[model samples]
Target: MKKITLSLSMLALILSIGMNEASAQKIKINTKGIGAAEKGLKAATFSDADAAKLAGEAVAWMDANNPVAGPNDPYTKRLNKIFGKHKNEGGLALNYKVYKVKDINAFACADGSVRVFSSLMDIMSDEELLGIIGHEIGHVANKDSRDAVRSAYKREALMDAASSQSGVVNTLTESQLGKFANALLDSKYNRKQESEADDYSYTFMKSHNYKVTALASAFQKFADMEKASGDNRTKTEKMMSSHPESAVRAAKILEKAKKDGLAAL
Candidate 1:
């Protein structure tokens, strides 16, 4: 318990170093109707501001509820090392953490919060991890995260935004906050969104002169893990279930790499 508390304190310190008041101002949670969006009633559209607010709330809730790997953890230190080597030029001052969970997953929010599972870091190479992080950043750059949030929240978002316009405060309940976290974490993108993000990742790697095969290799690792788990694959590969099939995505990555001359026959 002491170790966990110490880790959390150190993690908070690192996070505070990476964050600034200006960044926090970008996602002001005090706005009216920002988080009070009701559940269900589809119409996937939301302003950037709305997405930022929800993302901030979702990340905050996730951080509080999850057992995050602290700064002193070997996995967390390694992940920070890998994450720091990248250039996040897609309009977000990204901050990342490794959650101390066995789930193999990583996600990025519109608010530039990226949470990666320690299990994922343990399994992936540094280059492979960068490819995955690039993919997550691609989602943020393409505004897919915002659209997913809006769609999952439905008309409630519009209503709340409207209420916000009228200066009516709309705060979320504890239940609503949990729902938002789940929605953000488990949101599924369509084939198009997934493919587009894949392409963005490819370009991101190529631009950095990183090995393009890292992306394909990462996907192949997931595919192998899936097959190895058999019936228990669902629990092991929870992050891949909502995504494009790993084998298919891997093939696409190879195809793109070859087409760009990053891979040879």
Candidate 2:
């Protein structure tokens, strides 16, 4: 759920593209440009609140930079229709939106912002998408988002973008926000954390009485996609490479579901 191996488009890592929905502004960021913001990052421990606030700023920048579907758009309408009722799932306040991108991915920020890509919605059924959403939110509910931002700042070698001697979140310049967002995007969760989030996702599905098989089915979809990969290593192929055990993981999920008497097949 941290980066849903389904469609986190490794191409975004290579190209650093951001397509805005409202103004349709496109931003191309390079490592050198990101380095410039290093001048503002002060070394400090990022508190949970600070992490959430920083996440909020980063999400705001991302929402402005990415192609978010409008309220009237089918993607937005469908997400709203299905997830609109559960504003506060797993005791975490949440907001949902659809990004009109071809990438089959979804992510959640520490600030309770969840964005689903239209392509992901296209390939997945409602319950399966819900399972994916649950997994992503699991990352947040378990405070993985909080830890990820901290780790990201450290990995980027720029712990605080707040421009403060003491650590706290504050208004960031657009460029500074971009730097923070990049760091967040580059953050990677460990296998343990990801595994925990997957379990949390199943727990979420159980609590909601949603079809738990969707979780297994979702992973099976990833495995199937990987099998159907092309000769040239596309971005999806790269993503699948990073998560080579998709089919195995899916099998594990199915096994667990069968034990719980929840598997249909």
Candidate 3:
């Protein structure tokens, strides 16, 4: 009886140690994952291969589902011109398309795919449009889109109630795709990133000789729209929910412009 009890106690102690070690390992993995993300951001670079793969997947999904119906000929021409100038400038293969959404928004994916909304172009001048495009391009150059993609994937898994599935994940439904698009558009980037993108836009506009003031003007326009649509939950929520306040963004850009000797237009 004594021998049996001693063996049982030894087994129980071993099991407890094993459980503790497993828990610690999990904690270490979590910490390491977070550390890697932070390092990626600090480095401001992404793996070109990873970006291309993600872009291909995202484009395929968008093509099959949310087909954009805008003036592709003119838009593609404009994009080719802009991107052609920047080709070989960055390591990423930056590509763009104009989606037929009426929403005044634009977004870049981790894989160097940029989607601009038609309504966004309707509201802005050519210079203003360039500013917005430059900003999105900055996100790609900085690997912000890749970081956002990773963040979105994690968030979706955490938020989904039916996350217990094995192996492959299915494509999002149309509604889910819309939700994802909106989320990506309205997602709040870290302040550092926002500032960096702003700086990149300034440099891009300055280098290309586009009106840098358009950056601030774009934000002001968004801010005014937000104010005018007060309490109209949909517009207001869309404007303010995911992004930093337009006023704040405008102010920061203006400050940067002044410092960079870029006068208001």
Candidate 4:
């Protein structure tokens, strides 16, 4: 239940999307206070290029550290078959890969690095998987991923870089990159951002002429998982969850689907 914000469900890695319940890795949030340089740097000063560059570095470090599915692996095959042609999805050129992990989650990085976990694939249908991944992509396209990296960049550029004289993100060491990844994943998306990501998932399906209902169904699956997990959060605990309940998100999608004649309510 760390501050990981995911799309369809909480993923342990808490990539751009977090696992609501998946607990493969528990990345402790950096509790260190911002330095004078980080405090002086305005969050608004970060450009889209800075976001992408930082994301690229962090994702590269993660890719090298984690076990990636090979080209001929079933996970990779499935992802490529479904998403290869859409490399330029959402106007961003995306690189897709599958992580051979047990965590049921997927995430889209700011640089359009879309990573899908095999465990998540095992549980979700292709269409449902698409919905979930689309939601993750929504985070990137909507700049949620960018925002997550901005904080990490600010902290790392100030802490690791010899001088923040250029007033932009600077390179980080391997150790600092690990911190950068953790900070990026620990970021939580507010209710509004989550809703927008859901909307983006819906739009992605609609545009692709895929089953838009899968978006709602995907949420329903998460809702069911939460229920089966015996969720008993108090108001304070629920508020600290960092994202809206899956049931509520499912309901919203169903309402929209019903209105659009895409699904029966």
| TM-score per candidate | 0.74, 0.77, 0.64, 0.79
The pairs that clash in candidate 1 are none
Q: Which model scores highest in TM-score? A: 4
What's each prediction's clash count? 0, 0, 0, 9
> Which of the predicted structures, 1 or 4, would earn the higher lDDT when compared with the native?
4
Query: After TM-score superposition, what is the CA distance of residue 199 in candidate 4 from its true location, in Å?
Result: 0.5
lDDT of 2: 0.60
For model 3 the TM-score comes to 0.64
Per-model C-alpha lDDT, please? Answer: 0.58, 0.60, 0.49, 0.66
Per-residue C-alpha lDDT of model 3 across residues 112-160, encoded as one tens digit per residue = 6666555566776677766766776676677766666554443442333
lDDT of 2 by residue, 100-120 (tens): 765566777788888777877
Candidate RMSDs in order: 9.4, 6.4, 18.3, 5.7
Global fold similarity of model 1 (TM-score): 0.74
User: What stretches of model 3 exceed 4 Å from their correct place?
Assistant: 1-48, 69-84, 87-89, 154-188, 233-239
Residue lDDT tens for model 1, 1-265: 0011100000111111011111110121222223455333223335776777777776675576557778888887888787775535565778888777544556666777776666567777888877877777777788877776665455333346665465443445655544444444445565566677777778888988899999888778767766787776442243344456677878988998888888987
Runs in model 2 deviating more than 4 A are 1-45, 157-177
For model 1, give the 10-residue run with minimal summed lDDT.
1-10
Q: What's the candidate order when arranged by decreasing lDDT?
A: 4, 2, 1, 3
